[model samples]
Target chain A: MEALGVNLPFLLVQIVNLIIVYTVITKWIVGPIMGLLEKRRETISKGLEDARVAAEARANAEKEAAKIIADAQAEASKVVREATERAESAGKDVRAAAEAEAAKAREAAMAEAELERNRILGDLRGQVAALAIAAANKLVGEALDEKKQRALIDEFFSGVKSGKVVVVGESLSGDAAEVTSALPLTSEEQDVVKKNISAKEYAFKVDPSIMGGLVIKVGDKVLDASVAGKLEGLRSTLK
Target chain B: MKRVWARWVVLAAIILGLFLFTGFFGIGLGIKPIMPHVYLPGEKLSETPLFGIAGLYPTNTLVGLLLADIVVILIAIGVSRGVKSGKTVLTGISGAVEALLEMLHGITEGTAGKWTKQIFPWFATITLLVLAANWSGLIPGNETVGLIHHYDHGYDLKQVGPITTIWDEGTDDGEHHGEYAIVPFLRPVSTDLNFTFALAIVAVVMIQVFGFRSQGLGYLTKFWNTKTLFSKPIFGVIDFGVGILELVSEISKVLSFAFRLFGNMFAGAVLLFVIGSLVPVFAQSMFYLLEFFIGLIQAIVFGMLTMVFMSQATQGHGEHHEEAH
Candidate 1:
């Protein structure tokens, strides 16, 4: 044991030294290390918690932004829809007003055109009556009676014979009467036609297209004794 | 290019070292490497005891112990101060100590459970102290530079540039210079039986303390188990015998623990020098690496065994003993 250096005092010294080392280690090394570990664990957990909070906050922010954007889009669409409706309504009103104005102008133009045609046809009737009178004077080798020839031409053009409308066979009564003649009727001819058809109002029109006849309309009934109507009847009978 | 210059520099250094140490081609100091005398015990530094008492003289192992202690304490201070300064992590030696201790703490917690707080300090202390002592041996001049004393089986001393070294004359003829031996100033304390036995004794005592602390007076029943001695026939006698054997094993634990660390570290130190003397150059570097690994392993093993025994003592004796069987 002496050769191995296991003397009593040195062994004792080492034991005492061991105790001191144990004290130093426990107080300094182990205690601080444990505390540091615990603190590190705390720091890590706190970091994770902060990150979680930030993430949640970011998610909330994103949701709110999405909601705001949706609201803005909805408002924009609503504004756009309202603007479109207003524009369409404004366009519809302008179109309707324009159509009404066009219709009124067309009606005025038609009335003026009818008056002009009737005046022209009236002038043509006078010339045709004069020509017929001269031809009658030649055919008979003598001058025909002037008043009688004038009456004959008036009867042929107005479809009125001896101051009575030949087209009105039966007595007619109505709220209004419309008379269409081949030429513009003189006042005397209009008074004769009105006397045949009883109505509240009278309208006189001349058309050369009807040849030498008169057409009368009282309410819904019409009396057709125009030359053109006679020719259409002959054609149907032939077919 | 940088790496290439470094290699050339290393090659130059190796040649220079060879020339200086070996005196190759009759240049430089003539080589006279003396094999150091192997001593089992730590040689005393002086004839008079430091404490002014017989057998209380200072020894080279005592110097080694102080060096190891200073290293451990300095590291402890650095780690504590680093942790105290609110740093969760440390660097350098403090970092290394923290890493090692933290690993040890994890192991202790896994094994010792609640008793980890009580048991882990001893584990740390022993590992650090033994580790420091073992590694200190690897320092270049630890077993070489010392006080020369006259002896029958020694070498002649030579003075070169204010340094004294052991010299061997080439011829066997009696020379003008005398023979002498060296008592190295520093030796690894782990090679001392006193330190190992002291550590072992403390560890075994702590094991019992944990046993008593955990089980109270019931722990004594493990050594003198009269509870089942007469109740059953064959198994009761066997249990009594086992209890007595457990008492015997406790004493054996001290012997095993002490000698295990001592034998390994002392043998490693001796192996290093023996290999160095046989092939004095870079061959010993390989064995140094070997010694480094062995030192780490032995330190961990010593600490782990103590921790296991302590944790075992803290458990129910009957259950664990049965489990052991």
Candidate 2:
């Protein structure tokens, strides 16, 4: 053992040295290194967690942006639809007003034409009376009275004489009566016809198709006093 | 291309100069390499005691211990400073030491589990000390440049410029002219039996400390298993015998640990010496590399074995647990 150098003194020195070295290594080396390693690991995991949170936040922001954009688009389209509807309704109102104005204008033009036709018919009635008086003078070989001839012509065309409807038949009582004449009636003639009809309401009209006399309608009854009706009666008696 | 040629030229000249200085072809002082004398004990440098203690003085292995201590201290300082500065990664030597110890720590965690905190320091320290001591031997002038003393059968000394080396004086008419030998001032501490024995004793003592720590006084039952002795008469003798054998094996473990490191390191040193004396030049470099690998393996093996034994001590023996159930 001595030859191999295992003396107590050397062995003691080495053991003490080992203990000292162990302390140095444990305190100054191992402890700090392990702590550093653990800290590094923790830092890395925290950074990863932060990155993950950032990514999640970014994703949520993108989704919210998309939602807001979609809502804006929907609102914009709704505004466009409402504006289009208002424009169309305004166009329809303008068209309806234009149609009403055109209708009123057309009605006024027809009333004026009716009034001109009535005046022309009144002038033609005077010419027809003069021509008749001339023809009677040639036939009788003497001139007739002018006032009597005028009166007779007026009564024949107007279908009224002395403020009374000469076409009145029996006692006709109804809710309304319509009097037709070959020429437009004067207001006094319409009033005479209304009184003779013994109805609540009266409508006067001119129809040249009646030829000369009046055709009075009371309820469903008709008093055909036209010259065409007299001619049809005479023809039937001759046959 | 010209610079590359010049570099090769300088390198060849250096090799040729080495061959000439080492007396390759018996020219230029004709230095002959004498096979170094292998000593088991660390050779004392002086007759005087270093601390006035009888039979205790400064020796070559003690010098090697100091060099190894310096290396370990330097490593410790580098690591602590690097870690203290709050660097995420250590650089240079401290980085290398950290990487090596971290690997050892991983192994300790795998082996010892929860006791790794308590166990890894011993593993780290023992491996570092042994590794430093073993590698310090490989330095030039270690076990080579030393004191010359008179001996019965030894080599003559030669001086080549400022350096002194031993060379064999060839026989002249069947007579020897050399009567002196070189005693190196530094030998690796791993090659010393005292260091190896001390480490082994400490490791074994720690093993028992862990055993008692883990199991209290029940650890003694591993070597004195009497629980099964009275329970089963037929197997009682066998159990007692096995317990006694466990005690014997525990004693042998210390010897095994000590001699295993010392024998491998000592033989490696001897092999390098024999190879140097025989080939004298480039051949020793190859063995030096070989010894480098061997030294690292022996250091790790010593520490690893200690760790394994210590870890084993922390757990109850299987038969004891089985018998308890």
Candidate 3:
């Protein structure tokens, strides 16, 4: 009965107590705790699932937002590019139109200048003739007869070479015509001079005070047959 | 009805056979007896009280009850095992047994709410085993055995009739010397106060364990109970005094269980002895029948009280009041 001299009643009580404790812990404490743990686990799992779903939703929304921003940027860039292209094309058209207008204005100015130059040249030519006539009149002592002056101019021009005489004057001859017709001209010049100038009794009468004498003009030479010219010849003979 | 009759018939046959064997051969069969009066090992051997302040000591009855309790535990474990494994046959048998145990557990737990299930296994096992051990005394040779006499004064040996010596012996020299009348076989274990006290101590200790397990350290505070006292100082002193009384009452539970069981069984034994000795013919048989019923009833009452008191001790007073309501 005394295995280890342990109090038998005490041992019995301990055993009984152990049994009761085990039973109570198992049935009451452990069972409820397990149930609570299972419920907690389910709740945690559901929460995790919901969190995952929310996270996914947030990610999707973010992605959509990014896509929208990207699309907007692309659209904005597209609009910008289109606007730039239109601006460039408009600028090129405007530049080309300006260049064309400038070229037309230059052409018109050149033509107008050419016309003005020609009109001025004509007026100068008349002034030169008037001056030449006044100088000649001053040099001459008296007026020569028209027929005598014509004979003298013929006599002076008959002594020169046979070539066309070119007269530069303001008007066609009146008194100088006899002297101009007495001169012979080259064959080539004859045809051209006959078409361009008057051949019969041709004269270039600038002015009557260019001293009423026959002045024959040839290529580079001029012969003066006037009263002032005879007096200058006499004076030179005395000296 | 037929099964009940068959059980009765079998029990009668067993009794008849035992009676014949004991009456004719006097073979000294079954349990060996050591004394005319039952000797509880704890009371005889222990210098300290069996369930002293230190706690209870193990005795022969305690050992027997423990063995019986172990068997009950094993059976319960087996039943629980079957329940876990989904075995149909074991499940069916276990279910029936578990249902009975569970019903008892439910009643106790209903009183304590969720706490009863925790203590149910130990409580039920102790109750059933103690009940069985107490009733075992009614078996044929439990109280009847070959006799050996102690000296009327000292240590000399004598001889006597198998069961008659318990009443006849006294000190031979009249010097107030204590001597034991020895028997060759069986003793009714319950007749010993030591055995009953050991069982009570175990029940009491288990009640504490259950209380602690259910309510934690708060259970110990129930004994002191200063909360209400604090509110009402004069009432508190009285309540504190009552707390001391409660401690005393707890100690009395051991005495109650021990004295009640011992008194009943011893009284029944004495009655059987007187009746059988006075009229050795027909009255002996009649007394035997009465002893049989008395033994069963006493065992049942002891077990029932043990169950009830243990349940009460572990439970909170509030729960008891609620149940009463």
Best candidate, DockQ-wise? 1
How high a TM-score does candidate 1 get?
0.83
Interface RMSD of each: 0.9, 1.0, 9.3
Per-residue lDDT tens digits of candidate 2, residues B1-325?
9999988986786676467546655655555567777889998889898788887778999999989988988898998899889898999988988888888988998999888889888898899999999999899888888899887777677776887766666666645477888889889999999899989999999999998998899888888978778898868777778879988988898899999999999999999989877766567778999999999899888888889888888977844556565
Report the TM-score of chain B alone for all candidates. Answer: 0.92, 0.91, 0.60
On a 0 to 100 scale, what is the lDDT of residue B53 in model 2?
80
Which candidate tops TM-score? 1
Instruction: Evaluate all candidate structures by whole-model CA lDDT and list the values in order.
Output: 0.87, 0.85, 0.53
* Candidate 2 lDDT tens digits, A1-239: 98788898889888998888888878888888888778878999999999999999999999999999999999999999999999999999998999999999999998898888888987777677788788978998877787887777779887788877677656677887888888877777777777777888887777888788888888998888988787888899999
The lDDT, on a scale of 0 to 1, for candidate 3 is: 0.53
Docking class of 1: medium
The 10 consecutive residues of candidate 1 chain A with the worst lDDT sum are A114-123
* lDDT tens digits by residue: candidate 3, A55-170: 99999999999999999999999999999999999999999998899888988997687556545644554454455445645678565564565434433333222243333333
| Candidate 2 chain A, run of 10 with poorest lDDT | A163-172
Give TM per candidate. Answer: 0.83, 0.69, 0.41
Off by over 4 Å in 2: A68-239, B1-14, B21-30, B171-176, B318-325
TM-score-best of 1 and 2? 1
